[model samples]
Target: MKVVIYRVGQNQYATPVESIQSIERMLPIRPVPGAAAHVLGVANLRGSVIAVSDLRKVLNVEEQAFTPESRLLISNGNGYVVDEALDIADCADDAWEHVGEQKVWQRGDQLIVWEDLQA
Candidate 1:
């Protein structure tokens, strides 16, 4: 399967490219009171409003200050905040050798979460 690899601090995570609507630059986010810690806020993408979640917080990775270079990954009206957007690459057959029923995939030692973000 093809996926876009992104970094959360020093760790890496991958999500299917088909599941992503678009990758955008860091924009102003309106704080949502009473929202989850990982739920950063809402932003106007194109013309639609969407909630942005911090992948570092939700995925339990070390939190790093989001810089101007940070990217917003939107899927199903919801956005995921990631440190850096890496390349889109195809996974080799051997890479999926140990994956089970979990929505995540194991590529060597890295834990690749392959969720259908739209759902």
Candidate 2:
């Protein structure tokens, strides 16, 4: 299966390309009052407002620096934070393992974890 690999903190993850609505650059987030700590804020995608969140907290990874590689993975009208949008990967079917609500696979030297947006 073809997947889009990305980083959230120091770890790399992958999700089926078809699963996401779009991949966009880091967007300006407006703080939301009384929101969760992991809730970065909301962003205006074109004209629609979408909630943005940090995946690092959910994955329990230490926060990392953001660079030009940083991007937002849009799904279900939400924009998820990613340290970097790596590349497209072609992984074997047997290489994937269903873990919780996510799918994990090996990509070269590291493991690429897939986060389920619907969960």
By lDDT, the best candidate is 2
Alpha carbon lDDT of residue 109, candidate 1? 75
lDDT of 1 by residue, 33-73 (tens): 99999999899888888999998887788878888768998
Global fold similarity of model 2 (TM-score):
0.87
lDDT of 2 by residue, 66-100 (tens): 67888999988998888888888787879988888
Query: How far is each candidate from the true structure, as Cα RMSD in Å?
Result: 2.9, 2.0
How does each model score on lDDT? 0.79, 0.84
List candidate 1 segments past 4 Å from native: 97-119
Please estimate how well model 2 matches the true structure, expressed as its whole-model Cα lDDT: 0.84
Which runs of model 2 end up more than 4 angstroms from their true locations?
Answer: 98-103
Clashes of each: 0, 0
Which pairs clash inside model 2?
none
Give the best candidate by TM-score. 2
lDDT of candidate 1 at residue 54, scale 0 to 100:
91
Q: Estimate each model's TM-score.
A: 0.81, 0.87
